[model samples]
Target chain A: MPAIDLSTTPLRELNQSLHALAEGNNETEWEVLNPDGRHAVAVGIDAPVSVDIRGPVGYYCGGMNKQATVTVHGSAGPGVAENMMSGKVVIKGDVSQYAGATGRGGMLVVEGNAASRCGISMKGIDIVVKGSIGHMSAFMAQTGNLVVLGDAGDALGDSIYEARLFVRGNVQSLGADCVEKEMRDEHLELLEDLLQRSGITGVKPSEFRRYGSARKLYNFNIDNADAY
Target chain B: MCGIVGLFLKNEALEPQLGALTSAMLATMCERGPDSAGFAVYGQSLDGEAKITLQSSSPEIDFPALAKALENEIAGAVKLTQRATHAVLTCRRDELDTIRAAVRRLAPSVRVMGVGEAIEIYKEVGYPTAVSERFELKGMKGTHAIGHTRMATESAVTTLGAHPFSTGPDQCLVHNGSLSNHNNLRRSLAHDGIQLETQNDSEVAAAYLTWRMKQGLDLGQALEKSLDDLDGFFTFVVGTKNGFGVLRDPIACKPAVLAETDDYVAFGSEYRALVGLPGIDTAKVWEPEPATVYFWER
Candidate 1:
């Protein structure tokens, strides 16, 4: 493990130094000190490394990551791990829009609430938000699993695709293609696994309900044209 | 400092007369970014073809000679057909920057201004309405568009220091907050070979997005890529020929709302600004998530 001190060095130099370290060295974990909401703190890393951002970030904290695990001790701005291809990004605080959006692979775990379009158009990524989510949480989500441990706001999955959604609390309303689904054995098992993976404990597994695509709107039927 | 409007027709067939719609929306936002106004409307049938509006500081220079030089030297096939206090030209999409550079060289004393999309960027030291009228902005149209009214806190407020600054042809940005580390980020973007047009902090954001977009990323992906890299407490709106997108700062200081129906979608600095548009469902008008990106493709 190594250290990148952002306190005295300009954030650009500090980030560059860290990126260089990740690129040139073999250290698997790096500790950052005095990180104050800088953008692209640890972006475009291809190695298996863990970066602990000690403070908040402005936006796109660990974007386009592959085989890297970045953790933010504070809040994050919009687009954390956006378009990520592989690995894991864990934000301890709240995250802004399109968190893990269009992600082809990997997992994003947000311990706090997520803003609108949390997992928008996600492809093959699994997102577990421990708190509530805002409007259009998963708009046009083509694939992946969005597991929310709390409530969801308006348009949970409007114009959705094959993505599966599981919510533990009340849903304000379902979007265009999203609907309530039965919480069966497989769903409970999936919920338990996601909760455990997200490090969430103490809540009963049966307390949550499952919601996903109705599959009727997958092909855009003329009869369902009026639905939108 | 500036305003931008863009129209992308979904049908890509009718060449939707978006002039009136774009003009109307841009007019409403004159107060948001009064320095300049411009619009970029792409042809309906063309995959990425575009129509652009430009303004220059030096009106006396001959634009045709510069266009010729661009064609001969830079391989930019451009032609100047109209000349005014603010010059207008119909140019090849790939030749935009080259034509702009030629204008700068040909007329060193004058300012070479707004290019790409239907954006008619204007800049001055005054109100938005006067500039809107000066640009004759009420007549333009498109399918979907966005505009900005700016109050500059950092950077010069010149024509180059306007809102809805173009990162690429169709990707334009208008920001309401400041970037905390714009200088460093600007240097990084410049290091990546992306040009910086303005000293405004918002341009740093615009350049970041544009640079990412040029790397073969979609509009949404590019925006997401910029989030962690761009610092500050800001809310920004971007209108591209392909779609409309908005993002708020982490703390969510500035206010924004997303209102959508099957027919239309709108986001504004204030809900009242969108009051004039059709189909207002009070129930559907919702505040945007902080540090979140809301993108809709047309």
Candidate 2:
């Protein structure tokens, strides 16, 4: 394991140094110490390497990530793992707004709370939040699975296109065209697997509920006009 | 700080380009602030008025009184209506200075940043694009402009407290970082009879530059004085009728990236915002020096 000290170095220099150290066919697990809320730190990593960021990030951390398992020891700013294609991003602390936003693929696990608009416009990401999420979470979500262990705020999943919402706690309200779905055996099994993958094993899978779009607003329907 | 972007073509050729450019800049700096967004478009003449559009805090002061005072004291014919905090007014181009002066007098507690004849300011409590869309910013037009997206750390979060703050006639400023000597400088400027509008630390810097410019100092000299007098980590860009100026604190705590070519010049809180612009001279990209003043003439 290699260590990159970013105390006094600029973020671009730190990224260059880390990338330089990771280059040359060196697939080493690197530890970034004293991150100190830098923006775009450890972004666009493609190598099959693992990185552990020490503290909270400023913005766009781990953006467009591919094939890199990045873990943050602290909270994240907006657009964490944004547009991610592959790999895993694990946040040990609460995350700021727009976590996994517009991500196409990969898994994002938030151990603590997440701010508003989490997974907004997400294409194909899997987000598992152990705590609550703010209002307008998953707005305009095209395709994704958002698992929230705690309560959600107002207008959850408003204007969603196609996304699966699984919540263990109370939901404040459903967004436009979103309705509660029956949690059956298949969903329970899938939730169990996701929770276990996120390292949350204590809760029973049957405790959670499922919510998704009723397809009422997929096309313009004069009969269901009032639902909109 | 705030983001300012406006385009004033002699014949309305580059409205789309300017709006796209401003939107790109704001989107790139979205993380710089996710608070409020507002903007103005200058060419729309409704009822033979200049059709100045503005966004601000809701349930504001009376526009009639503001317009009447501006008409009497500032020498402008002002007609203003409030939709929430945003006020769209129309006045003669010559009366812009008087309107600005009267606004300062009327809204002493309001941060009057971003004052220009064709000025556009977009600020809210979120990313710049979202705020811009909420305010329907795509149709704004002029020859040139300025905008701001604010991150609330030192000041309270309100539409009245957003950026692209106006200092004087045809002058607007967008600030990125803090000004440590705001209180002391505010008192000194107040002693010089410059009434302040907001509690924001950056407002003092904007007002200081405006007062200096009002005293016949050029933008470069006023910015230089601010670099010398104002304390703390600040990187700001000021726009005027002539052009725009960029300044940074000696400590260099804030960050600004500049990209300029023969056709256009752009600046952002980050470089990615300007990455995919038209006619981008990627090689000429550079960050301005700390405590240095850089301005572009119209």
Candidate 3:
């Protein structure tokens, strides 16, 4: 394990060192101290490594990550794990807007609440939020799964596409082309598996409701002009 | 992008440190907004006296002569204290409108930054640290303050385009994002008799709040109405005579974090701006929700 103190080490150097590590190297465990809410920490890493950040971080933490496990002990700013390719990024505390936005793959978990636009435009990632998610989460998402245990803010899944959404708590409103769908045995089994993989418990998979695109605007028929 | 920091003190004992603490917070956000900076400080107000902050491109020639001219016109004692590019003119409370009119006539270049019993605004087109130092913000004493550092997106980079745009008596606003409908809204607000100062969209937001408050809405109500009337991405921190309010647009693309302790309530564009506050590690930190109004008043 290697320890880098961000209070003294420049963010560029720390990220460089993280990127230098080879895949499956023995020194795969790293620790970041005194993050101090700096932006772009541990970004663009493509190794199978673990990074434990001791404090809060600013925007774009673990952005574009692949096969790297990054965990922030404190809260995170906006765009955490944005466009992540693979691996996992975990926030022990709350997160700001657009957490896990446009992520293509891998898992992003927020132990606390996520602000507006959480998982916006997510493309194939698996996002699990233990707490509430803010307005417009999963908006225009092309593909992925977003699971929330707590309540959701206004206009959840607005104009969504191809993404699977499950929420156990109340949704303030639903967006265009998004509607509640029947939770069949397959969806229940998938939700149960996702919950188990994300280490979520106490909430039954049967308690969740599924939402996705209604597909009415997939090709834009003339009848949909009034809704537009 | 722009950075905004606000401090509202619940304990009078911390009044002396408000400017220093707010300056530190503003400095941390210099990277987010490097074009221009400004701040509004709320100090102790005196009965029957008003403080009018004014800015002039030619401070040396205009500041001295304007104070004497204002004194003669209002028939009262006028005190003018000059910072680098700004000056605070203290006069009888009732004489503010007359003094303002006189300034418009006497020195047309002198811009009225703010007029109130307690609020004094200082702004410039420079780095936040330099602007704060030029105004001696670190040594000032106040109960609450709001500051902004801007990266120009909506308008040209000028001293007049800075944040902390004050539109009414003791009312000021700092915005982070550009409004899509400000041009139309500005015309409507101007039609309603709210004097607008700049083409900047944020000035329209300040004037809109002023117009709403003039119509007998409280600060919270004005902010609530803003969600419906104002369009575009915005995270606004507003300062009043005794209240501080924060509002985010419905989309909430911009970032805003809030931290509150028993002694103070603080707002920052990001969590990094708040890392230097006293008891911040123990403070209750949260992100302001979209289309919601949060205000604290004495």
TM-score of chain A of each: 0.89, 0.92, 0.96
Using Cα atoms, each model's DockQ against the true complex is 0.02, 0.02, 0.77
Per-residue error (Å), model 2, residue B103: 8.6
How much DockQ does model 1 earn?
Answer: 0.02
Candidate 1 Cα outliers beyond 4 Å, as residue runs:
A1-228, B1-52, B59-85, B93-101, B109-125, B281-283
Candidate number that wins on TM-score, 2 or 3: 3
- Model 2, A1-228: lDDT tens per residue? 767777766778757755564445665687887775567888888767889998666578888888788999976766889998988999987776688999998899999988778899989989999998877889888897899999887788888888889988988888998889999888888888888888898898888888888787777889866976
What TM-score would you give candidate 1 relative to the actual structure?
0.51
- For model 3, residues A115-178, the per-residue Cα lDDT tens digits are 8899999999999999999888898988989999998888888888899999999999998889
Candidate 3 Cα deviation (angstroms), residue B213: 1.5
**Number of the top-ranking candidate, with lDDT as the measure:** 3
* Candidate with better lDDT, 2 vs 3: 3
True contacts kept of each: 0.00, 0.00, 0.76
Docking quality category of candidate 2 according to DockQ thresholds: incorrect
After TM-score superposition, what is the CA distance of residue A88 in candidate 1 from its true location, in Å? 48
Query: Model 3's DockQ?
Result: 0.77
Model 3 residue runs over 4 Å out of place are: A220-228, B72-76
Q: What's the lDDT for residue A150 in model 3? A: 90
- Cα deviation of B54, candidate 2, in Å: 5.9
